[model samples]
Target: MRISKRNLILGIIAIILIIIISILLIKQFSKDEKPDIKVDEKKQDTLIYNTNVEGIANINNIYIYGMHLNLSGEVNTTSDISSIELVLFNKSDKKRYNLEYEYIDNKVKFYLSNKINEGIYLDEILKGEYQVLLKITSSDEVIRYYSLNNNTAYSYMDYYTITRNGKNNYIEISTLSTQMVIRVTEKTLPKDVYDITIDPGHGGDDPGAVKNDIYESYINLEVALKLKKELENLGLKVKITRTGDYNPGNIAGISPYGKGGRVAIGYETKSKLFLSVHSNNLPLYPQNNGVEIYTSTNNNKQLASLIASNIVKETKINYSSKKQDKVMNGVYVRNFTTSEINTFKREAKENNYKFYETINTKTQYYYVIRETGGIITGAYVDGRNKDYSANLYYNSNIGLDGYLIEMGYITNSNDLKILLNKKNQYAIAIKNAVKEYLNITN
Candidate 1:
């Protein structure tokens, strides 16, 4: 068994090569196949570097709704940036998706909402855990940093966005740690935990749109409770603002989005959608009646038309004749007007309070609609007013898709009769709309 040194070296090399080939084959034959990253590995290596650019490049907020996401921060780098892209990097298989972004005035903004028609869609993505990061290509250096987690980004940290399809998909966007992480799993959620919240406006001390022998508060509760029951029956989890006659959040004369209040309940429940039920009143025009649904003027109007159409078709309600803030057949977006903004500005000055710059003419007048919008729809409740409680979820990126439904005017004889009588019909209409929106099937 005398062997030459060269022969022994050749044998050792062959064994090493066979082991490497076998490992490669095993990886290729594995059940799970990950999508490959197109970029060169050497170039991609720079992305994980923890370069503390601080004020120069930072992500301040991360907002999520269903599959829709909006990220905001500032990038005040002195380097000449040629391009910027949002990177969804998965550490497991080195998978990544680079998305388009907007960088203006050193302020960075990114959107993953198909409604905005600008960013990535969850449907096009693969199931995996991914970390959000910014990749800024500049003359000086390529900056890659994890989406920074801010102080107020905790509201919807545990929220999950489930999809409807041949097979179900679950998406959880978390900022529990320093960086924002998105975990996409394929599983059905639990039934007992709710994802939709229904708010019946006006309760207890404040009776909304009261009329002789008929109170709007009781009528709203009646409709909302029915709606809750129907939604649950349809296999959807539902939470109401007030199960009975008392309000959960702060009372009226204060903000509706106040702590434990109407709008706050939606965020607290981590709801994907929230509906506020109310009966309208117009003493000036007693004949004014019909259904009107309100959504944030700044957000999408898809839910508005769906719910409005269903209510009108299924119930005895008519289209609202009060067309002041009407945006469509039965939908309305009652944000602040320029005149109203001026009045508020004056009042702010007189009261020695600082007016929020976010309260422009486009800002929603109804706190239920506005404050539940999170950062996407310019929601702002930063504790300015001493008389009212601050909205805890005002700065949340994970806001509830909220709507207000004014069933009918209480002053109108015919409309009032339908409001008081056709409670089940209204509930059925809303439940149908919810099913349609969620793409739920039996």
Candidate 2:
């Protein structure tokens, strides 16, 4: 159509401006906008891992223990998903890492570690502050970014140790404003800073055993404190699980494998020896007396023997009269019975967890001995047990040499008296045994 020259020029300019505005609007809408979680400082506990994708993405549980970080979530969408991955971004260095993951039936589980081509990923380059994003791609090639939240049924402070050239890089995962964040810090442990970790078993609400008026937690702590002093007197550095009357390991939950508890203390300290001092209770057989020294099957029994012998001699408490799993007069290597193994298998099946082939009748029944040994000692709990969280350091090649000591039967009159009165004697025996075994001249 014929028109005036100025009018036509103005008309083209208007059209161009209109087109540019439309393009800018489209780009703005296409950009990935992060969902606001509105994490209240006080109400952080109510926050859960829910991506603001309507009903498309919601993470149920995230198991971060030892050298692995596992996640299980649901993709509540009718459309088929092409793939799901965990995206890691380092802002300080402008680096990015795409983590491979496994997803099926709206469930996701994978390892986030420092090794390559194995369940444990050992990439030291994964350092600095990481902003974690869950990348879910649909079959239609549409991509969505989700902020991984801290609603994994409990609070957690995950420490994934990455070792290289005899040093450790602790990959700590924590939640910031309801989103998951990873911070990698290099730590150099001293040669003999921590020689032993003495655990006063069942602190706070968890009293190991109970009698007329005695609490096992109190006895354990008393003995542990004394033992700590004894070991220190011999020029050995010691770390006790808990000093106060509360459960140090039960931060957000009971005995969380990596974050809290005796296992966490043992793993974190990287101590040479881990001694869990606990009292036994046989309510039905109140006549049972004396000490029971527990050592795993694969462990060296020299320490156990020394502790048993020295404790008996020093405290004048003979070996346990019970014949179950007895290796010597006072020493025992307690393992899962056949019936217990069957029960474990059944429980795993019911709970939808992988039944560990590593666990058998010979596997240590005590979590302190078994879970502290890592993969070498068949530490198979990977956050499968609903009651206890995953043992984070369960698969580490470098772990602690753990031993559990039953001071005496708390239910027995004779044993209870010694356990309450002769805590120092028991501590001295354990200390002497450790000195002889380790050849600590100091």
Candidate 3:
């Protein structure tokens, strides 16, 4: 307390210096505790794929029938695919087109532009082969290219008509040229003393109607065999076109050789009549149940009626009024212009007998009836709502007298049950009808 003035001033200066130094240290410590404000300068990694070179097209299921090309496949990669198109290159012109495609079930399908209306007619297109490619483009601006290979070919050349039988028309394209054709060897017509030729419709590849596990072909064969045995027992000569699950010439329906072989057998045996046995199933109308008898021409109406009467009596099933025996006029082509008719006539000569008859005015009947000489009582139910009709007359009398018997509708639960359970009864009914027709009193 009694210190000199110089001593007090020195103490005051020392305390101020201590306070400033302490303030500076405090500020420096605060600066160190504050977090650094550094902007993030990192980027994300993206995956990119290359598709510049040719690769095995990722094609799964692709089939080319005539001019029609069916394509189906899945994209295995994770890239966003914007479009997948089929590219067709005409060998002659080297022309290309990106045909429209539809995506369904993780697959794409398209027809080459000219072959676009439902399906393209190969004959209408060029005569030579064309290069096919599948091109896929992704949202990331990458295009994947694939080359298509043809695996299936047509059996005949010079343009085989799709309507081998009297069914609908379809075009067939062969990978091989016409020069490499394999003709269906001609068959010799037979001459035996057979009174009747029984045909069990649809064998081998053609499985007519199918429901659950039941096949129409199976039922037709069963009934046909039973009838054959009955006819033999009645002391009448009988011949059945097919004895097993296979068709003649391994062809289904009335292919040139298949139908020709069967007919040749009949002609060789001198068979007086032909009859086809078939079963029915309606995909749209499962409730339809009945027995039907059909005659291709008026000449066979009585025969059809006799058989139908017996079938109803035996199976105790309702007879379809729509299936009543009648002469159906079979028009080869409907709504044809004069020029089209002339063209059709000219084309008919190049076709086989079946194809010719299909194009020309022929007896309008079920294929079996129209071509093989008989009526086809197709099973009653159909996807379309309409009355069933058959073809009646033909320009040429090549078809033999015939009738078609649709024993019962396989689509109906009750009918199918009866067809499966009471097959023998139905056979007996047909036998009785044949006996009546022959005037044989056993």
Candidate 4:
């Protein structure tokens, strides 16, 4: 078969073109068959980079609680680290943050603040879960990623745990049984142990005052628990004397460290302020009702007044003011024989007690007032005579302020109604008073 040279050349070119198209079709088919091939290629790239890199950075024991983030671990590299920074992502809001850091002892601590940027505060960050990228800049940059949302176990880290030391709660992370503590706060916490001590009066065997099936001990504990929660929410550390129905032991003639017994707990916890919640009782006069606050001394009269005023204003309950001495002048004592009078007087002198047959008495004479230590009120003696003095001046000598709140008279039906029905309102009132007293803006 004789053919032209041009025809032969055209046939060769067509064959070459068909071969190229077939190769393209085979490659497209392979791609369709293995969709994950691209991912494998990317992983290969990462593996190669990691092997070539001499220095590696690691994030161990990452902890996020409240507004604080703690990162601990070592970055091993030949090159010195020039800078270290964090990139935080709010998964819910899709907002991102870039935080600079200074490392100490192979650990970095970051505080999230709105002052850092708009809506980047701890409260806002705590509103949702976040993911973080820790970037370490040396001769080359190394990134270690972590997530606050996941429970997935990683090789070098254990799940976080929470614990409380006295009043402050801490979120802790550990690696190989070594723990790193992360303190959560809106602002830097005070170095002092705690801001307030809430003493729930008359616990365990001592059920304070009991009337109409209402236990004052129960009421005191309930109110104290609520107050603790409220103050903690405000970022204040608060301690309670009895988490359950237990006392620290007696004080003086009173059990559980009678009089200033609670002061011992305050001292142990290093509490700055003390509050004893209690229910009042008037067995002689059932008509005596309303709220009364007894300060350990005159110094804390202002704190007492603040609490009293708030309760009265919120609940519309009467404020039971301390009575004046002249108000009870018309009252008289029984005419006793000389022998009987001598016996009573002898006992009174021995106890250094005053026989007051009248209504007027100093509220500060109570043991809780005299003994509760810390920044508290002074002992108040109603009379000038030392023999008849009721005040022990226990708290006053130390310049600590303590207050006993007589929430309401459990003996009076009217007061009982408010105490039982409006218990939460009373708590709120007390919380407001505490906020004002502490000068807390939030």
Candidate 5:
């Protein structure tokens, strides 16, 4: 207890040193505290961004040169998005078009400039699928991606149902191009319609079918003239392929054989129908006489059949004798070759095989049923497998209902007499058939 002053100071210094060591240890442990590692759990378990597209779109009318696509869609984001970009992929060429747009009012309108040289033709652009991809970035380092599968640009006109997982949404959009097809009633006398093209078949060197001295072409012209008179009386516009008993060259200036023959009549004008009149001659031995109607490959077969049936019914001709056949006659009639026939057969076989692959059935070979109009040849699928191979020629362009009427046989003397008489019962029968087919009451 009785210590010196120096000893007391040393003890106090030792105690101070001990206190400093403890404070240092406490600070070292405090540095290792990990700062509580506070983690704020996200309110939503999964951040999702739902996207939708809308509009009427058609690919056919789209011109790619200097053409831009306008994209507008609504996005529902679970969290605030920092940035968003739309990715458009052209499936045809495997090319991508990226467009960036700022978020506004929970929606975005994006425009992709077509100024870049893609070296893609407008026709090729119409043939491929287009995909729309949406990428969204959020503040929480979470990224959500959404994609829409739009194969054809023309499908934009219809409502698209998008189901993500189990959730359902709708999208409507339109492409820049669209194609429209208009058809008119056939076999009926032309009503007070505006545009019409009357085609008298087998002109010039192509005299269609001949029988004895009475050429099929001559009879065709006579009936066509009568039809023209009736059509003109109805206050309708009409263009005749031939007016008199002469060759196509005789039309002087307005005919196709003239200098401007390449220019197709009624092509620029909105023609509703093309009626080609002709008289068919069967084999001289059989003496088969009846009315037969033919339509272009791309024309509506149902309508053609209706007109043909009405003609047969009105004339009281033997339905059994008349070939109620759907033939690809239009294509073959133009020019028939062995190569073309083989190609057609091969395509038909492939289509048939594809169709039966999914189902169990045998394919049948029918000539007329297999051929489509030159334009619509691509749209024709083998009725067996539904596989598309070639398109019809007529379906490829803006087309109208075309009719080829075989009035009577010129080979038979009895048939010749009926056709020559202007007031013959055959003419009355034809008039009644026209009335029924056109649905004309008067």
Candidate 6:
């Protein structure tokens, strides 16, 4: 109890030194127990839209749901955004829509709800060959443009038209969305004799060559129907322009006269013969009785001659004289003559006789022949014209020998009877003529 002050002071000092050591030890242990925060490697997030390079997105990883459209992408930004707005437009009607965008963890999505116009969406639109404008912008004025690839789906409307120039045929197509026009052209031929185009002289307000109770249009159609059946039996194709005794109207660019108002049928045939069935009517004497055959005055004159000769041989009908004539009617005949004949005459002068000639001892204007530029032959304008004259026209026009066989005259009682008789000698002759024209040796 009687301790010295110095010793007490030493004891206090020792205690203070022990406390300091303990504090230092605790501090060291605390430093060792703490865990370290690892640094994350920087990686770029990718944003892709419909597998297209040009999609609108500022940040990656967002959710967007929309009607008519869908989007997908990834986001790397830490910015907090509730939604993005997408604008869609209808290219055809120029209509627009504001689509709502949704955001999820690192993903954005949107939907387009506008009803697509049918007229603008063609069946081929899904092919993605159309041009579209994509605009992406934020409220802060940041804008971007993207040209979508052929992956986008679309709806469109298509319109088409068909036309012919010479042997060349053209088909035109138009689109309402882009207002673009496309054209396709190809060559075509007539189908068959059954599918033959029988142009009734006139009807539906235009009565052609009326004589008593007989109308040329009615006669022409009747004969054509009979002839169609005959040709069909012969295993030949036939098509009639006029099914009944009526006329639809002047075909596109034809005339009202018996010459202009005739009908034509196109064949998908390899043969180049065009048979125009008709009844002959004259201005002076209504007593003409015989069958007449007309052929193109153009390159098909030979074919025409063959047709005429066969018809004559089979029907035993008299042929009219062969003469140079001007064509004034029948679009196909006139066109064939003009285009084909003009070219033929220039190429083969020795075969010029193959062309059809007019019987007008006065003017050399054979309306059909002249207009067609093809050879015309078969039935003559006058009784004096030989039946062989018709053959000459066919020979000249087609170069393959053909003819225009006028069945018989409606004005002549005997001729009319022959035309109406199914088993008449003339009918047999006509059938034989077609066989001969085709050159079927059997």
lDDT of 2: 0.69
* Per-residue lDDT of candidate 6, residues 121-167 (tens digit): 11122221222333445555554433322221212212211111223
Candidate 1, which segments miss by more than 4 Å at Cα? 1-61, 71-127, 131-156, 162-181, 186-193, 251-255, 382-387
Candidate 4 C-alpha error for residue 220, in Å: 1.2
**Per-residue lDDT of candidate 2, residues 391-423 (tens digit):** 777766555667899989999999988998999
lDDT of 5 by residue, 313-349 (tens): 5444433244434352211112234465466667758
Q: lDDT, candidate 5, residue 41?
A: 17
Task: List the candidate numbers ranked by TM-score, top first.
Answer: 1, 2, 4, 3, 5, 6
Give the lowest summed-lDDT range of ten residues in model 4.
325-334
Best by TM-score: 1
For model 4, the stretches where C-alpha displacement exceeds 4 angstroms are 1-192, 251-255, 258-261, 321-363, 374-398
Position 442, candidate 4: lDDT: 56
lDDT of 1 by residue, 1-442 (tens): 8999999999999999999999999898662444444344434444533344233235565556544565555555555666666666654324443444566775555434334212444544567666666666676676545454454535245445543443445666666444655667776655533568898888887788888978899999999999999988776667888988776664555566666677767776667787899999998899888999998764567778889999999886899997699889889988788999898788878877777778787788787777787766677743356447477766776667778999889999899889888999999999899888767776
Instruction: Give the per-residue Cα lDDT of candidate 5 at 415.
Output: 57
Q: For candidate 6, what is the TM-score?
A: 0.35
The estimated TM-scores of all candidates read 0.70, 0.57, 0.45, 0.45, 0.42, 0.35
Alpha carbon deviation, residue 12, candidate 5 (Å): 99
Alpha-carbon deviation at 79 in model 3, angstroms: 95
Quantify all predictions' global Cα lDDT against the true fold.
Answer: 0.71, 0.69, 0.53, 0.52, 0.42, 0.38
Better of 4 and 5 by lDDT: 4
Which candidate should be chosen as best, given lDDT against the real structure?
1
